[model samples]
Target chain A: MSGIYSERHTLEKTESASETANEPVKKGDTAEVKESVAVNKMRTEFAALAVNEAFARAAAAAFFSRLDPTVEELTEIKTAVSEAVSNAVIHGYQGGSADKTVVMECEYENSGIIKIAVSDCGVGIKDVEEARRPLFTTGDAEERSGMGFTVMESFMDRVAVESEEGKGTRVTLIKSLDISYYGV
Target chain B: MKTEFEITDNILIAKLSGEIDHHEAADIRSDIDGTYAAFKKKHIIMDFSGVSFVDSSGIGVIMGRYKKTAENGGITAICGCSEYLRSILYMAGIFTIVKEAKNKEDAVKLVKRLEAAESGEIFQEEKEAE
Candidate 1:
């Protein structure tokens, strides 16, 4: 699992949140915003293992922490990531194939918006709309509650899903940081 | 994930600690459900104060147990959840069937009432069965 993260540690820090450049720098001025946009992308090819469900969540949570989200917001993101990854592992790969990979990408804007995407190379959903409905699970064989998409939609600001049958699925989730938490 | 269980009378209280995700929920659901059956408990109280993190799968675990216990004429209550968890529970429609308590003691009292009601003591027939 650690191998997935180390594969791509492309950290691009963009100074998008600061107006320090607009301020005239006096001789004694030492104050600056000192913040930047953090972009990170990682991919993992595990055996559709159940333990990787937590791994996915942990990885996403760690990535989102760069934005300094509140505990509540962090929990919400973690839950959303867990649902997407769980769907990939259980429904996508059907619990393990010889060569399967789940790719996750996250971008944190200095303006406090976080975007996350989890993609898998496995059997994709036939109908994305029906899947998003509450309690609309296709994995009845595993006692799945069918609440994965519902949970993701509920926790994140927006959720988008794209899939092709016999191809794969990709889910995107977005959440803006609560302004009160950042005082921005 | 770590689970601690304490039984008094017919109520089984389970305290879940650590992060709860799909993986953890899978094991926790089995463990708690198994313990609930093994103890022959009439009600269940889940304490989430020790739990630091939870996702939708955690919601699934609690919902599954609530249904299982309810089917057997038992009650399930939750206590010690963070404010955010309470919000999630409400939005997920979990609050419709399962009630919330401020703490374990309060949950026990709530379950006592529910158990009494289930046994027909709160309504009538306290003496019919006795």
Candidate 2:
């Protein structure tokens, strides 16, 4: 699990932007955003237990509710979070050891963009490409659909995977809401 | 999650309620499989009306049950899926193998019709039309 600590350190380095919570951060004149935007971030670590799956979804929903996302968008995000967390529990931790934990981080900007990352310290994925394929599960055939990555990819705009064979895996998902279309 | 089972005309109707995730999948599976084994029913109808949420694990549960029923020379039908659930199931290609019914009654009717067809018995609808 030392790898998990290292991963956390790296995340902290990149998350400096969230240090000024609720404060408007100035963005460079980029096509995505030209105005200063309020940014919020949340992070949680929980035991790699299957029961925590529902908890994780609720946490994400509650945190992102400030955006006033549409019902459809909310459900889509929750489903993607569930898939990522489930992968951390079932595959990353290899059936979930009590000592192991899954870490989740969510960062949202008023610009209608959200980034979520779920990480676990366990046996990491060897073939990221194959794992992303629909119905390519290495788990029990009868109990696993091997559609975790597929579902996440379908629900979110982007899905990124990082892993080491013996260390762990981290999955990051990002989605941008069309707030103007929804009039939110 | 909680599941209620009703046996009618040798068909098992399972009404599942609550969140369907990996944590609750084992219990659901045992409940359905146990009752299925006891009744020796050939067809199953999974009613998802009470279900609030589902992930990939739910897909596994459905696929596993579908395989079991098919192996026993039976079929599986699902009814009362929310639109969100339907999309997820469709993405997983579950609908290609498992029939979707508008409601529990429709599912029961479908299974009965299929059963009769398999046995070379004329369904009442066809008989009446004749």
Q: What is the TM-score of chain A alone in each candidate?
A: 0.72, 0.81
Ten-residue stretch with the least lDDT total in model 2 chain B = B121-130
Candidate 1 lDDT score at position A145: 60
Listed in order, each prediction's TM-score against the native is 0.78, 0.88
- The lDDT of each candidate is 0.73, 0.83
The residue-level lDDT of candidate 1 at A26 comes to 38
The regions of model 1 sitting more than 4 angstroms off are A1-47, A141-143, A178-184, B120-130
User: Where in model 2 is the C-alpha error above 4 Å?
Assistant: A1-38, A180-184, B125-130
Q: List the TM-score for candidate 2's chain B.
A: 0.92
Clashing pairs in 2: none
**Chain B vs. true chain B: TM-score per candidate:** 0.89, 0.92
Give the 10-residue window scoring lowest on summed lDDT in candidate 2 chain A.
A1-10
Instruction: Judging by lDDT against the true structure, name the best candidate.
Output: 2
Position A141, candidate 2: lDDT: 89
